[model samples]
Target: MPSYAYRCRGCGDTFELSRPMAEASAPATCPQGHEDTVKLLTTFGTVSRGGSGAPVAPPAASGGGCCGGGCCG
Candidate 1:
């Protein structure tokens, strides 16, 4: 199930709901009992299985095909 964010116009409250994608467009009622609510556009984050916390990938090993093998020289 994916979580959808919504904002209430009557109470000015923001909330989230988890439901099936089929019912994503369904009407949402805020906790303040406000029927006037609109779904907010949310961005999904990417998942990285990398162990390092760095933003970029690790550098390649010194021993490689071209330069390491001295082919370019």
Candidate 2:
């Protein structure tokens, strides 16, 4: 089950619920008993690090290949 966030339009209440994916799009009732609620879009975050436990830096841009520079014409 995944948690879904919802906001009530009737009382401006926000809440979360853990439900099946099939019911993710289903209607939700706010804690205040308001049925006029809408599911809120959610975002996920990821954490990554190098083997040394340091934050990994993005790969540097290549200097353009065989020419060793952006001068291959």
Candidate 3:
């Protein structure tokens, strides 16, 4: 699951939601019965698991390849 930011075009209200990636672009409306709402591009306040907190993988170490067998070929 991921969290996203959304804004209401009718009432100018902004909010966040934890939804599936497929539903991120679903039709959403304001609680005030305004159907003219649109999603907004906003930065997240903090990095959480549902947001930018997604983990990043690290590169593997090769222990310094081709060391000449400790003195010669």
Candidate 4:
């Protein structure tokens, strides 16, 4: 299951719902029972840690191309 965020235009409320990924784009009703709701664009991230329970920084990207490698000349 995945969680989705939605905003209600009628009351300007924001809410979240947990549902299957297949229905992620389905219409949602706000807690105030407003039908004029639109799904919000949300971002999800994961932290890789070594059992320390501390948040880990995401992996670094591999440089590429001339400019990326500072070889543009």
Candidate 5:
């Protein structure tokens, strides 16, 4: 079983539920009993960074700065 985060579209309430992966998701609702809702994209606490490893953001400034002047100046 895994935990999933769901957000209510009616009252903007966020909640988490734990259930089996094969089990169908229940209709999420607001605390006011509104049935109009949706499940948000699931995210994990810690992602495995083995094998290919995690992606790293590129470093800033690729040594292309030209003395605080425009490129064509």
Candidate 6:
């Protein structure tokens, strides 16, 4: 079973559900009993350790990209 995230448009509530992948796209009822719910895009976070056994931080975003005030052309 996989976990799915959903948000209720009726009450603005968020929730998660564990179900078969086949029904992952099925409509879900919110915890508050709202039927107007939609699945939310979810992301997973991973932790990496360095040689010293300390958690490694992610690299900083490059400042030369289109959204970083750099020319895209």
Among all candidates shown, the one with the greatest lDDT: 1
Q: What TM-score, over all chains together, does every model reach?
A: 0.66, 0.66, 0.51, 0.64, 0.49, 0.62
Q: Which stretches of candidate 2 lie over 4 Å from their true place?
A: 49-73
Q: Can you write out model 1's per-residue Cα lDDT over 1-73, one digit (the tens) per residue?
A: 9999999999899999999999999999999899999999999867588756557758978865767866765
Instruction: Locate the minimum summed-lDDT window of 10 residues in model 2.
Output: 46-55
Give each model's whole-structure lDDT. 0.90, 0.88, 0.75, 0.86, 0.70, 0.88
Could you tell me the TM-score of candidate 1?
0.66
Clashing pairs in 4: none
Better of 1 and 6 by lDDT: 1
Better of 2 and 6 by TM-score: 2
- Per-residue lDDT for 1-73 in model 2, tens only? 8999999999998899999998888889999898999999999977665476667789997888687787886
Report, for all candidates in order, the number of backbone clashes.
0, 0, 0, 0, 0, 0
Clashing pairs in 5: none
List the candidate 4 regions with Cα displacement exceeding 4 Å: 51-73
Candidate 3, 1-73: lDDT as tens digits: 8877777888898877788989989887777777787787866565556656667679865445476344443
Return the clash pairs for model 2, or none: none
Candidate 4 displacement at residue 28 in angstroms: 0.6
lDDT of 5: 0.70
Model 3 CA RMSD to the hidden true structure, in angstroms: 9.2
Scored by lDDT, model 3 comes in at 0.75
Q: For all the candidates, what are their Cα RMSDs to the real structure?
A: 7.4, 4.5, 9.2, 3.8, 7.7, 5.9
Positional deviation of residue 13's Cα in model 2 after best superposition, in angstroms: 0.8
* Residue 19 displacement in candidate 1 (angstroms): 0.9
